[model samples]
Target: MMSAVVVAARAWIGTPYLHQASCKGAGADCLGLLRGVWREVVGAEPEAVPAYSPDWSEPARREDLAAAAGRWLSAESAMAPGVVLLFRMREAAVAKHMGILSVAGDAPKFVHAYSGHGVVESPLSLPWERRVVGLFRFPGH
Candidate 1:
């Protein structure tokens, strides 16, 4: 399953960054990338996502994405490779970013889509670790 995730995520490497979009060989946001991966590894998305703005949770002061993830995915206590990660950019902000843990080791790593960088694998450094608010696994795996 972990290998399946790495294979699927690596295929998104060059996709352009697009807010709220999820299309391989084109554009996708962090969540979009996860959605695409779900389609490949699990099945169709569990639910249709409502349209959302880039700042969807900023003003609401809600962890909408985390809540939604919890509803669909099973949380994992250990940082296992291929588990999904939800991050909060700030202590007060809602959890927003999502990624797949590709390497869970001293030099941990994950794959995600960012505005300027598109899709890329990043080190799960202190800065990134501090932002992690939730951890989940693909269902039925």
Candidate 2:
């Protein structure tokens, strides 16, 4: 199941970044990428996502994304392939970015739809690790 999640995420590589969109090979933001993968691997979304802006939850200092993940995904502590990672871009900011872990071990990596780079695999380097605030697994996985 974990490998299947990784495969589904990798299939979204090269998708253009589009805020609020979730179509593979067309466009997707970080959340959209996750949503796309969920549709492929986990069946329909559990709930509808409300419209959001780029500066989501920042002004209000709310962890909207993390809250949603908590409701629908199983929280986990250990890092492993297929886990969803939520990151805080900066100190004192709400976690808003997310990715699916694709590779674990020495050269750990993750797949995400970066704003400028679109969907791509990135090294889970120290910098990225430091930003991770929450880890989760797909429901029933």
Candidate 3:
């Protein structure tokens, strides 16, 4: 079941980054990529997502993305395939970035739609591993 998410997420690789967009292959942001995967694996989005800016533009303590992910996904204590990773880009900033853990073994990796880089699966490097503030699993899995 978790692999299903990885499969779906991988299909979006090469998608150009587009803020507030969710159409795979066309464009998507980090949240958009997650939302698209959720729709494919979880049936439909639990709620509509309102427009929001990146961490740099948002207030330092405003954690809307984490709050929403908490509401729709089950919290997890450890990283696992298909689990969502929430990242706080910098100290004191909101956890505004998100990605699905695509690989969890020796060469851990995650699939995310990065600004300017689009949707790409990158190694779970130390810098990224450090900023992770929360881990969550899609409901029922």
Candidate 4:
């Protein structure tokens, strides 16, 4: 199952970054990447996602992403492959970025769709590590 998750996530690589989009090899945002993977590996999505702005819920100071993850995903402490990583872009801001773990060893990597970069695998460097506020696993995984 974990391998399937990783495979699904990797398949999204090269997808163009597009806000509020979630089609593989087409366009997707960070959350959209995860949504695409979820559809591929976990059947249908549990619920519909409302439209969101680029700033997300930051202006409202709401942890909307984290709250949804808690409701639909299983929280985990281990930083293993295929885990869902929720990041706090800033100390005082809501966690708006997310990715699926692709590598968990020394040179850890994750797949996410960034503003300038499409869905790409990035090394889990110190800067990225410092922003991780929560880790989770797909439900039933």
Candidate 5:
């Protein structure tokens, strides 16, 4: 089951980044990548996602992304392949970015869609890991 999630996420590699969109091969943002994976692995999303800006409500300091993950996904304690990874772009900022852990341990890597990068797997480098504010798993992962 966990491998299924990783496989599904990897299937989206190279998808262009398109805000608020969630298609497998066309385009998707960080959250969209996760949403697409959710549909493939978990049947359907637990709730509808409203249109959000690139700021992700940071002006209000609302942890909208983290809150939603808490509500729908199973929270996890440590990094592991197939876990949902939520990141806070900056200290004291809203946890806005999302990714799926594709590889864990000494050299971890995660799959995500960024503004310019599209869907790709990146090494979970220190710079990226330091920004992680939340870790979660699709229910029953």
Candidate 6:
């Protein structure tokens, strides 16, 4: 199951960043990447995502992304393979970035699609760890 998620995420590698998009081999944003993985690993999306701009939660300063994850996914105490992660870029910014923990160990890491980098696996380094605002698990089997 974990491998499935990783592989599915990797498939999005090189996809161009397109806000609110979620199609593999075309374009996708961070949340779209996670949504793609969710469909692959869990099933259809739990709910329809509303049209959101690139700066969806910045002005509101609400943890909208984290709140939505809490609504649809299970919480986990620590980083685990294949778990979803929500990040708050700044103290006052909303949690917008999303990723999946791909390696959980002494050297923890995750995979996310970024604007310029496309989909890539990254280390959950100090800066990244500090940004993590919430963690969630895929429910059911």
Q: Write candidate 5's Cα lDDT for 8-126 as tens digits.
A: 99999999999988998898999999999999888878888998998988989888898899999988998888988999888877889999999999999999999998999999999
* lDDT of each residue in 38-137, candidate 2, tens digit only: 9998999999999999999899888999999999999999889999999999999999999999999999999999999999999999999999999999
Clashes of 3: 0
Q: Model 3, 15-133: lDDT tens per residue? A: 99999999999999999999999999888888998877654346556678888988998999988888899998888777889999999988899999999899999999999999999
Look at candidate 5 and tell me the lDDT of residue 82. Answer: 93
TM-score of every model versus the real structure? 0.95, 0.97, 0.94, 0.97, 0.96, 0.91
Instruction: Sort every candidate by TM-score, greatest first.
Output: 4, 2, 5, 1, 3, 6
User: What lDDT does each candidate get?
Assistant: 0.89, 0.94, 0.89, 0.93, 0.91, 0.84
Which parts of model 4 have CA positions greater than 4 angstroms off? none
Worst 10 residues of 2 by lDDT: 1-10
Candidate 5 residue runs with Cα over 4 Å from true position: none
Q: What TM-score, to 2 decimals, does candidate 6 have?
A: 0.91
Flag clash pairs in model 2.
none
Which residue pairs of candidate 1 clash? none
Cα misplacement distance, residue 22 of candidate 2 (Å): 0.3
The better-scoring model by TM-score among 4 and 6 is 4
TM-score of 2: 0.97
Candidate 2 wrong stretches, greater than 4 Å: none
Candidate 3 structure lDDT? 0.89
